[model samples]
Target: MVKQVRAARTRQALVRAAAEVFAADGYAMASLPSISRRAGVSAGALHFHFASKDFLAREVEDAAADLVQKMAGEARSSSGTVLESLVGTTCRLLVAMAADPVVRAGFRLGSDPSRKNGPGVLAWWRTWVHERVAEAREAGELADDVSPEGAAAAIAAATVGFEVLGGADRDWLCEERAAQFWAFVLPRLAAFPQQAMATVTGAGGVR
Candidate 1:
């Protein structure tokens, strides 16, 4: 039991360390030795858990996707219009990414096309967004002209772009940018009725 716990801790530490390295240096420039050093683990120990950098990158991507899924679940459970839920979820995710080194690195690494390619983390997010948009449209919250697939692609692109921009420049105004995005998107999402707008403003105001 103790060995298992230690192994888990070690693996977690490695992932955390790798994420920081990747976030700072990007996937192409980050190295296993640097990650091992940051984690205070030997290269051999890191290899024991992750055979190669690609494996480590995949693990990071999985961890990020898990985080995104959790946030999406939370948003779905909260009370609000589909658009509000999406915006709230996006805010939560952005906040989490800002605080989590692993998540930041995962986003950075996953955004790079030169990295791993099996269905990728961003693709999963896009699919999730597409499904949510379709659900909202069916519920009569979205405009008749709204295309789920197109909206999903746009949202995904905007989100990734925001994150990349925020990460690159410390002085970038993240909250301002997010608010601008919401301002522009909310009206388009509320093409149906006042009730839909109320859903976003009432009890579940993207807390």
Candidate 2:
């Protein structure tokens, strides 16, 4: 039992450290030695837990997937119209990626060309945006000119773009910056000016 506990703690540390490394450096650039050192564990211990760097990356990706799934779930479940949910979901995600290293790394790994055999996080986010926009269109929230596919594409692109930009300047992920995005997008996409602006400038925000 003690050995199991120790192993579990060690594994968690390795995952966190690996995430830090992967988040800072792309998967191709990240190294096992750096990860082990970040975890404060010897190379032998890292090997004991992960057979290779690929395996370690997979673990980091998995952890990131779990975090993203939870974030998306919360945004979906949050009380609001599809439009509001869309806005809130996006804001939350930007904030999360900015604040959380593991969340940031998961997105990086998911986008990395080397990781095959699994659906990527960015793909999953795009799908979510597509579905939400469809719901908004059905509810008569979207402008007649705003096709669901087009709106989804724009939002998905901007959201991912923010991730890329925020890596260098974290201000891109802040609520105020995200609010600016909503301010720009809502005008073009929302059918009702009052309702759309209300959602964007809402005190409860993303409600």
Candidate 3:
């Protein structure tokens, strides 16, 4: 039992270290030795926990997906209109991603050619967004013409674009920037009625 607990702790420490290394250096540039050093463990230990760099990267992606899904679930449960729920869910996701080194690294990894189309992570994100958009549409918060799949895709793409553009240069302002990004999206996505538009614009404090 003690051995199992120690192994679990060691594995977690390695994951946290890898997250930091990947966030700072990008997945392609990050090395096992560096991650081990950051975790205060030997390279052999890291290898023991994860057989390969790809395995470690996939673990990071899974961790990020779990975190994102939890946030999405919580947002869905909160009180709000469908558009509000969508925007709120997205905002929470961005905030979590901004705060988590693993999530940031996973996002970078998902976009990189070397790690593209690995499994589950990006697809899960797309599906989550699509589900939320559909829910919003059904609730009369979104226009009838709005394509739930397309809008979800757009939100996912825009969120990624902002993250890439902001990069490490503007890490401090990620949440603020994420809010601004969603503000731009809310108006276009809400039902086209003047009252709906007004509510959205007013809620976001947009002029």
Number of clashing pairs per prediction, in order: 0, 0, 0
Kindly list the per-residue Cα lDDT of model 2 for residues 1-207, writing each as its tens digit.
Answer: 999999999999999999888888888889999999999999999999999988888787778778877877787787467788887777888888888888788788877776664646777778878988998999998999988998999999998888889888988876666778888889889998678778666433354
Identify the runs in model 3 with alpha carbons over 4 angstroms from their true place: 116-119, 171-173, 192-207
TM-scores of the candidates are: 0.88, 0.91, 0.85
Ten-residue stretch with the least lDDT total in model 3? 198-207
| Candidate 2 C-alpha error for residue 123, in Å | 1.5
Compare the candidates by TM-score and give the number of the best one: 2
lDDT of 1 by residue, 84-134 (tens): 677777766666677877667767877786785664667777788888788
Q: For all the candidates, what are their Cα RMSDs to the real structure?
A: 2.8, 2.1, 3.1
Q: After superposition, how far is residue 130 of candidate 3 from its true place, in Å?
A: 1.5
Off by over 4 Å in 1: 170-176, 192-205
Ranking by TM-score: 2, 1, 3
Q: Give Cα-based local distance difference scores for all models.
A: 0.76, 0.82, 0.72
- Deviation (Å) of 36 in candidate 1: 0.4
What TM-score does structure 2 among the candidates reach?
0.91
